[model samples]
Target: MPSIAPDGKPESPGKVEVQPVAKDNEIRKRIADILITTSWFGEPRVAVQEGIVFLKGTTENDEFKQWAGDLAKNTEGVVAVVNQIEVAPATIWDFDPTFQELNDLARGFVRLLPMIVVALIVITISWILARLTVYLLRRGLLARSLSHLLREVMARTGGMLVMLAGLYLVLRIAGLTQLALTVVGGTGLIGLVLGIAFREITENFLASLFLSLQQPFREGDLVEVAGVTGYVQRLTSRTTVLMTLDGNQVQVPNSTVFKSTIRNFTSNPNRRDDFIVGIGYDDSIPFAQEVALKVLAEHPAVLSEPEPLVLVESLGPSTVNLRVYFWLDGGQHSWLKVKSSVIRLVKRAFQDSGISLPDEAREVTFPHGVPVRMIEDEGAVESATAKPTAEPETVATKAEASLQSEAEEIKEQARRSWTPGENLLTLSSSTDDS
Candidate 1:
């Protein structure tokens, strides 16, 4: 008979074998050996059927049970493995319960109860003091006419400082100094992150503070900010609110307001109104200016002290442009109404003086001498062909009368909605927006 090796292969012709070729029992034995060697998995019974391994046992934990099956599956000659192992249910011995443990926990709570109560009391006192301090500061600042925004900043900063002090004391009293330090350190990091994320908000807030301190335009002031002209309704930490002439609310960022040009119309009681009058090139320039100044001076709303100015500004294609400048009491009369009055009065004065205001003229030429027929208005025809002795009525007088009637109508309409009162500064109730 030929000798066989452990792997079931025939040995060399002259070699002697000490053990028969590996069999099912040997493979099973090898798997069992591996499982027993693993200390994490308590003894799991192993059986091999048709070169397949089945594990059956309970371990201290699922990890150990899983390890037993995995170990069998990895062994040589094991086609497959079925892990039927389960974890042993926890027993009372695991907790080793005793009244002493409960008694120790209760005693610990009792020992710390007094310190906890003291800490809470300290925090409460601190909060009350902080609020009182803020209230007092607000009253004092408001009395001093300090900006509302400045007052809020000072009060909040003071309150936060006081609160921080209180918190530190509480932590110390409760023997949490390490925790207090951790919180303090973390606060800086949190603030850094928030500052980076909300840079625009921070910039606007700072700009608002600067604006409040500078006092560029107060509430209710008519101002032109960044080309937006309106009445300042409110000033918040981030935005400046305006009630536009169109009756819409506009919120402009404080940063933009601070950076852009601000025209404060309400700052001055007097404002100048300017308009251009174009007269026919053939008209008298000096006569036109004289008539304009006279018309401006005669108007009740125009200021006499400054004296109205009329200068030949430029010569246009069809006329000589006269720029008329006049001063008015802006506080008493609406700028628009005053300007409209000036234009009407100037137009009438020019007509009465026979200084013709020019209009655009177009002359079209025919290429082959085409005959042209001119049509005139019926009113113009009646005026041209009327009797020379018909009261000698001047068209200027009729035009002036029509203008006066229209002015009275406008005045009546304005009176319906207008109330007599001086424009006062709008005071904001609070400024703690940031």
Candidate 2:
């Protein structure tokens, strides 16, 4: 029978017989022959014993050393590889790998050039859309009733949303979908932290928005709110400014102003004022009431339609206390001046009518007989007790000028010191008749 080769093909009669197992020398020679074909730091020595190959060499880098070891291990009949290959120390002139890495990076960037250009175009379009959104929002009906600050906030918010959408698309085009999601989520997280950190400021801002919408008080309107009584000057996002009665500026937080009760004095042109006047108990209450009413009725600033009232409030130890109530045009006259003038005229009228205002009576009981003292100044005593003989001079009774001038001055000062847009109220409310 003809001998068959390992491939199960019948061998030719002239072919030499082949051995099934390779010799150690043959394995070593095979690896050495392959090594000579490539460039290396130095020629290495290769040895094999019982099919185990041993390699020893020096190479310029670990990659070359690893390549030599792998070459030996893949050789025919190799059982194990003991690679004692050493990599040469780097020299200052060795920059081949670094240059190769840079070249590869440059090639990759060139490959992504088209994507980068598209991203830039997307960003530009997004920017234009953002600006257009802002313009449209500002001119929309939604902004008509909004305050300047609120309008700006809304417009900017709308624009930012557009820009964010553009950013997301750009990030996706750049193949950074995960990064885009992180950016969006991080923005919301940062906003939440800021809101919590500035809780009071956020509250004030929201309150200001509501106040601007509601318009509880307008600029130049006399108002009392948050324990402050003043003329409203301006309303900012954080605070509500007022010029107090003493002509001092006060800034109350919008949150406090919104939560507190607001008393608008200028809302109604007519206001009522009252004061207590005490007269001697022997004087007839009806006559004193008539005299006081006459004084208020005769005053030019006093409003007669409301009809002034004089009621017996209480009886004191030595006098009868009367409560006098009267109305006046608050828009044209200062209430302080009107009340002061009315008091003065009423006192004069009482004196002219002989309505005695007596002091509180005090009684003293002497355990011993009252000590008598002889008075040598009889003429002085008589003069002190004598009533005035001249006729009572007429007293002037009129409301002084209103505080509108002072408020205007304050408003002027605010205009000089602050921006006109800071004022969230219209001038119509200040100039309109109540």
Best prediction by TM-score: 2
**Positional deviation of 264 in candidate 2, in angstroms?**
2.0
Model 1, residue 137: what's the lDDT?
Answer: 78
In order, the Cα lDDT scores of the candidates are 0.72, 0.79
RMSD score of candidate 2 (Å): 8.9
CA shift of 302, model 2, Å: 3.4
Per-residue lDDT value at 77 in model 1: 68
For 318-381, candidate 2 gives per-residue lDDT tens digits of: 8899999999877777778878778888888898899999875545679998998666798988
For model 2, what is the C-alpha lDDT against the true structure? 0.79
Top candidate by lDDT: 2
Per-residue lDDT for 1-434 in model 1, tens only? 33346864333333212245545677677766655665434566778888787887776666556556656665666678888877885566655346768888899999989888898899999999899888887877776445666778888888877888899889878788998888778778888898889999988888877877777877656789988987776677778877666655677888999999999877886889899989998888888888888887777778897988999999888889999999877666666767776787788788878999876665466888988666589898788778665222222234343222132233333334332222122333233221
Q: Tell me each candidate's TM-score.
A: 0.56, 0.71
* Ten-residue stretch with the least lDDT total in model 1: 420-429
The alpha-carbon lDDT assigned to residue 293 of candidate 2 equals 95
